[model samples]
Target: MNVSLLLILLLVGAIVTYLAGDKLASKVALFFGLASLGCTIVLLNHYNLGENISFITRWITQPNVSFALKADGLSLAMVLLTTALTPIIIFSSFGNEYKNSKAFYALILFMSFAMTGTFLASDGLLYYIFWELALIPIYFIALIWGNGDAEDRKKAVVKFFIYTLAGSLFMLVAFVYLYLKAGSFLIEDLYKLNLSSSEQLWIFLAFFLAYAIKIPLIPFHTWQANVYQKAPTVGTMLLSGIMLKMGLYSVIRWQLPLAPLAAKEYLPVLIGIGIAGVIYGSIVALRQKDLKKLLAYSSLAHVGLISAGTYTLTLDGLRGSVLQMIAHGFVVVGLFFVAEIIFRRYETRTIAEMGGIRAQTPKFTSLFLLLVLASVALPTTFNFVGEFTVLYSLSQINVWFAVLGGTTIILGAYYMLKMFQYTMLGETNKRIFADVTANEGITLVLIVAVLFFFGLYPKPIIDLITPSLEEILTQINRIN
Candidate 1:
């Protein structure tokens, strides 16, 4: 089977669900999500060793871009993450009642469609189209269904849309230049282009504006927390869980390999910015009173380390970046879902307003605690494996750099534990705290199980991603 089916299912599912009316929208979306995931798993499992999952068709003439969807080892892992998480993201929202269920579910599926296409597109211009396509559904989702003041929500979402799209404008510029130079929008064609140092620098900076803003590194991060805090839980999950990874994935796939010399030249600056984000995000998180806002900053800090690992240009760093990307995706989704659960009960985001959650809902407390520990990169959690490797990669770059970047581990624990203590461990709330519902319990359990299973044995992921990473490195080395 080809990779195109996976995306076709999501796009078709969106339209089908939109037509199904409110009664069956969520179910249709969930079914389609699962079908895509199931199909992906089967395709991945049945493939002979070294065989690629790919399909290419003529889609354009002037730009010479083809409808090429190829899932190499790297893309497969990303697609797997996107598909697997889509069902979970949808299922996590089953308990909530949106105003228009059909429309909301359709946006989610459309998002899945754009995101899957983002991962699978082997054509650079096609990838850019998919990249921009992802922003639309999310923009509508956040604007229409989000919580908070209408004007404030508009401000936040507009800022988010404009900020990300502005960054992407520069990226589009870079792609147009690459197409002009390479004469094709194919990934390999762009990769084969040999530009002068000046050209690489401009292209790298253009690409950097897009990815760094998406990753929301340091100074470019002003849009992140506000957007996360304003968006619905589902929107936040889509943004954090996989959308952010699009930026990181682009670094490996587009930035570093395309502008190898520029990336190497800017290594110190990028690592510094990444570490600054860790420190900056952690400090802000400690001061956050809103649970969603806190989680948003926490994401900033965690991804900072992953960003640092990525820019290091070492094998350990690259692999660790992917591993951490996966780990953070799951953990952030669980954490934000917890925030939603609490909001459903309390109707508040202020942490000070929450206390003694555990005294009432012991099941939720336990699950929340496990997720917190996992976020802090506690031992035997997948987060630990990812964090440790990323930090080790940093250490290889510079011991002091690792020391600075490593502060997130300490700072994360401090804020997360502080958050837990204030929110979950204080005097019991007067309101009735019901135990975990079946759907919520199942979601949390599944999340924890993955964090556990992978924490112990990350060999499969490591092995799966190593060959692709090696090829990327070889590409970089050849450029060198």
Candidate 2:
């Protein structure tokens, strides 16, 4: 079947499942998830030999908008990630006996559709529409299914919603300005326009605010930890695992090449913020007692490295950023899932409340240990590969920057191990805790296998992304 047809079918299936009610809702959603995965695999197979797929239909003519979707190596990779993980996330939700099962399953599938659209959108307006569209399901997901004080979750969700919407309005204005100047909303048209340096700077700042808020770098990151802490584990997984990459991806696709000189001029300041976020996030994470909050801060630190790498504008830096994004997505999701398991058993997220978990749950201990090692960038884990590449790229920019940035590894190990020792090792408290179930074990072991596989063989991913990265760099160089 055609890819677009498959996408439409997935949405339709979701709607149908949502109406099907509790008894069959989850099963129907699972079927759609598996079907989407199958379609994604077929799309990947076809694209492996170098093919491009695009579908466009006119939506508006006054400002010249179209519902345009295009898939290249990058888009396909993101689609695969979205589709592959959606099933696992759906499966993960099996453990929760939600009140409105149909609505819960429906939201998961709808989120899949929005994410797919975000990656495949080729028109600037269409991209923005999908970008904002992706946030709605998540907002409801967090508000309805989240843990913690109901009022706290409500407040956090509102803050997250407002911050993202406010930033995106800036992006909308920037896109409209580009549309006025370039006379087209198509990405390629915007890419071809030659804006004056002054204009580019303003436009770049507008785009930067939009993406930055989503990435939630530094001062803009206040909403993230609280949201992650309050949101359901599945919601947190979707936000951190796939949603955050949207911002980083846009930086590469829209910011750098579109406003090359501004990017170059602003590179140092951006890198400074990135480095600061890395240290600040790590330090703050050191003090977090809640596992989810700690993971959120660690995520900030990791993405800070990614942001810094992107500003370097070197091949190694860009490549590493992309690789790091994929690595971080997997590792963070796994870490949060482990957190969920612990919370389920202990009925608390505070690390101090738990002790000697490994003694009671050897399997959980083994998985948690692997996740910590990956978090700390141990050799032969995907995180190691990404961190090594990023630091290598940073060293080329400045040895000192690399040295400072490299401290994250030590700091990361310190906090992660400290948390582990406090929770997983040491003397048993004589409090009985359930071991990891077969389902949780399956999810974690699968992630670990993928982590190891990618670490050992990153060449394929590098090869797939190289052509696109080189094309992007060439564009930036031309404008520079």
Per-residue lDDT for 1-480 in model 2, tens only? 255765796788779889999888988998899889998888877778666666788899998998888777777777877887878777766766787989988988888888888888889999999899889999999999999889989999999999999999999999999999988899888989888899989989999999888987888899999999999999999999889888988898888988988998888888888888899999999999898999999999999988888889888998898888888888898999988888887788998898899889898899889989988889999888878998999899889889888979999999999998998999996778888788898889988887889989988788877888898899899875
TM-score of each: 0.99, 0.97
lDDT of 1 by residue, 1-480 (tens): 777878888899999989998989989999999998998887677553556668999998986989998777777788888988899999999889988889999999999899889988889888999999999999999999888999999999999999999999999999899999988989888888888888999999999999999987989999999889889999999999999999999989889988989988989999999999999999999999999999999999999999999999999999999999999999999999999999988899899999988889888999999999999999999999989999999999899999999999999999999999999998998877778799999999999989988999999888878888999998887777
Q: What is the C-alpha lDDT of each candidate?
A: 0.91, 0.87
For candidate 2, give the lDDT. 0.87
Q: Which ten residues in a row have the lowest lDDT in candidate 2?
A: 1-10
Error of 2 at 104 (Å): 1.2
Task: Give candidate 2 misplaced runs (Cα > 4 Å).
Answer: none
| Candidate 1: residue 220 Cα off by (Å) | 0.8
Error of 1 at 337 (Å): 0.6
**Highest lDDT scorer:** 1
> Least accurate stretch of 10 residues (summed lDDT) in model 1?
43-52
